[model samples]
Target: MSDLNPRETVQDALYRAARDLEARGVGYAMRDARRLMTHALGIASDRLTLFLREPLPAEAAGVFTAFCERRAAREPVSRIVEGRLFFGRWFKVTPEVLDPRPETEVLIDQALRFQFGSFLDIGTGSGCIAVTLLAERARANAFVTDISERALKIAEENALAHSVSERARFATSDWFSDVVGQFDLIVSNPPYIRPSEMETLEPEVLKGDPHIALTDFVDGLTGYRQIAAHAEKHLVPGGRVLVEIGPDEAQEVVQLFTDAGLTNCTVYQDFDRRDRVVEAFSTKPSKIG
Candidate 1:
């Protein structure tokens, strides 16, 4: 570890923290170290690099050590830092929600390409998707729903922070149970990870992320089933549904959408070239009960 002398410069502290994290095998060690230092010192990351020779305050050193210990234990950096940047905005995150992932940005891109007056986000953890959409498309009306009240609160806060609260609404719904109106675009990054595979996820996710937001009890496709089954009713004719799915699940999920009467379904890949988001449109309205 770099010398922890109270008189060491801020840059030195960051370097020491980064080295410590790297030795501990933490992913994104350098980035996490910089973030932790910035949080503890109340200095911008860019500035931290320039002040390497500057000594950190004694109290800041203590807080930085605590932050490093948490990160060393595999706690998500977002959780450790209390905020995560997504789609050019910072979102507050806690144990109540899943840390937003870059792969989900694919969903945003897909949404932007489509012509939709209104959007609905199912399982809107942290409201990242809904908030980003509203920020990007100012005229688009959006609603975000999550089964967990805590998650919904975070999403609401995010909406307000991003200045999109008026354009977006929050509701506590289990899928579409309480949603009343039809939307032209319905998007979700639901709990698609299979119960059986939960054990195989990274420690940061399996142990640190919210369990309810990361799983579907039956074969990991339950959320897709509910969304596909109910989407036609909640979506206007020709309205589309876009969802992020696990790799190798695209084919199965596509079939589920087809069986549910959604037509012209297609799977899109994320940056890693893995099958990721699925998009489908309702072709004909099913007979209402």
Candidate 2:
């Protein structure tokens, strides 16, 4: 069914992969096709154009076809590639952890605005949040928690990859149950999707992501409530919390933060101007403040 010949040029092979993906309605088919092709060929993406006329090695072409088949079946390219770019750095990804999302980078942006001696990340899937913080704020150490030990291990691997392993500690716990430190900045991109909403996510998303990382399987407010209730107790005075949230859940979540005694609550929008992050100051003002 492919237009590829027995000895097709790299471009022809790549084009055929894209065409096949497009036919299957794979969103971002062309881009993913190129990624799959380059990764399969073990070549740099920028080198793709240069190899257009070169015949793809038979082995590489076969690998490309397999990757294309997986893509057509709707596996996320990031998951298939086992890595994703978050906060401008690549973090290893796996089915055990959540594939880091670009929108969640807002947590990094907002947290960087304040100075913190220590950081806490709840549900630190893949360690993207915790490791990136430690990498950026060289002076800060982090305590990251996850309910899934498997996910915590993935986060630990990513922390090592980002060279933040020395500054990060990963724990398996339900929320803050076993967390031991007080932190100046507590952040999370928790499971905020509601149960019913889970069924509506894109097929690729549902397939490539861990269900535990995707939804609370509740009204989506469960994580918010627990974080709000416990985060304040674990924060250093005047500490701040910046949480990624469902766009429409801002008002309720803000109230939960307020109820937990976090002050100066503010909701921030993503680049698209949808409410994406909520920030609040702990009730006890620090001497440093």
Candidate 3:
């Protein structure tokens, strides 16, 4: 950056980056700037404070500048970097997979509250839910499906990374079309952001994320509709379905579950107290009967 030089101390470098990001309207500018600088420096974030007064090596400074430019250009901090932490673990992220949000962890929490054996994760981007669940349950088996092959690959890598690959199965399926057997637990964080809603989302948040993973291209409910219509066929008797819901979507998603004959539908909120997860149990037997 014209405003920063290699001879600058790490402290000054961070200051300049944070100021630049803040000037560009990043709400968490200081935090992101520090993280980016640390990433570029190849140093632990916790170590930054220890080395604040140290001058940046020319190579490190240039790398930091490039990363700063990417951030300034509206690239998501997660995507610009390597991976994101979810459920206490790091999952590799890419444009092919939707960046895992803290909100989706609500789905994991809700799913874990119930007992299950065979689990199915629809649109299992990054395999965070399935892999994490299998790791937690230890005895559970997972069958994960994603429409995007690239997304499935990343999920598989995540499963392997989490050491749950032995119990996890990956496939390319649209909704439940290719799912054969029933599962005691079915979960999804389906695309619910309506096309109309996209314009309202920050461009940087959407960058490097697949468009199909963001919107149904119809009403945002298309994916939910497919899930509602097909979930009954794949859920075993007494099985549970947990899907992460967008804000203001709990009522509609609950109705869809009820319409599909999944009973005891309930919406659960995240730590932010916003409706984030929807849970429904199968009182009726799997249609596979």
Candidate 4:
């Protein structure tokens, strides 16, 4: 008993999946169906249209059906694909780690503006930030940390996948607890969503992303405070810190940096014009060895 229609063409299957998604209230139903079809066919997205009139392979149809089921259950596309394209590179995604978002690219851009030979990424999650930085700046190295060992494992895997493993070190620690030495830059896209707001998040995010990677269980400022508390001591003279923040968290994060003795605090906006990254510099003089 074949579950897939033997006479169904690829385009027909895609339309059927899209309609199912729409009927289930999935946003961007057609778009997602197209993407999943490409994945199932193992073809480039642009080539999908060429194969539309061809019969859908039984294996591919089964895979597409499973993907649609997951999507209908509110799993993110990234999760369904088990990876995400971040800063033009693919990083693995899983329930144990936070899915990298486009807004975090603002933090990457801000960090790149500084000529840093080394940096530290707190709460590195999947190591998208640290790995991308190391990849972009071939001469740079990084220390990556995460509170969850499982998340750290994924981060290390991403570092390896990007060929940045040699330039990146991993640690399992909350914030800066296990971090060692100072660096020219510090970056993080920490958990900043408030507990109260967690329930209001989209099902794809609320159900797919790790809770520890999304909220602080308190005021959502806990990660920032933890980072601020030890940032100066771990920063080189005039070193910079760049952190991705919630759209409304710019002022509070700036104050945290200011109070921690960092100077030149500046807020950078994302493509959407929402406050997305906060950068600051340590004013301490170079340490004499």
Clashing residue pairs in candidate 1 (N, C-alpha, C atoms within 3 angstroms)? 8-54, 8-55, 9-53, 9-54, 9-55, 10-54, 11-52
Q: In candidate 1, what are the lDDT values of residues 1-289, reduced to their tens digit?
A: 4337787777777777888888888878888888898888887766876656667889989898899888988888889888898998899998999999999999999989977789899999999999999999889999789999999999999999989999887899998888878889999999988888988898999767898888877788989999988999888889999999999899999999999999899889999999999999987864444
Residue 45 displacement in candidate 4 (angstroms): 2.5
The true-structure Cα RMSD of candidate 3 reads 1.5
Assess candidate 1 and give its TM-score to the true structure. Answer: 0.95
Q: Residue 85 in model 4: shift from native, Å?
A: 0.7
Each model's C-alpha lDDT?
A: 0.88, 0.87, 0.86, 0.89
Task: Judge candidate 1 against the unseen true structure and give its global Cα lDDT, from 0 to 1.
Answer: 0.88
- Number of clashes in model 3? 0
Using Cα atoms with residue i matched to residue i, what is each candidate's TM-score against the true structure?
0.95, 0.95, 0.95, 0.96
User: What's the residue-level lDDT of 98 in candidate 4?
Assistant: 92
Model 1 residue runs over 4 Å out of place are: 1-3, 285-289
Q: List the candidate 3 regions with Cα displacement exceeding 4 Å.
A: none
Ranking by lDDT: 4, 1, 2, 3
Q: For residues 173-198, write the lDDT of model 3, one tens digit per residue.
A: 98877888899988998888988999
Count of clashing residue pairs in every prediction: 7, 0, 0, 0
Candidate 2: worst 10 consecutive residues by lDDT? 280-289
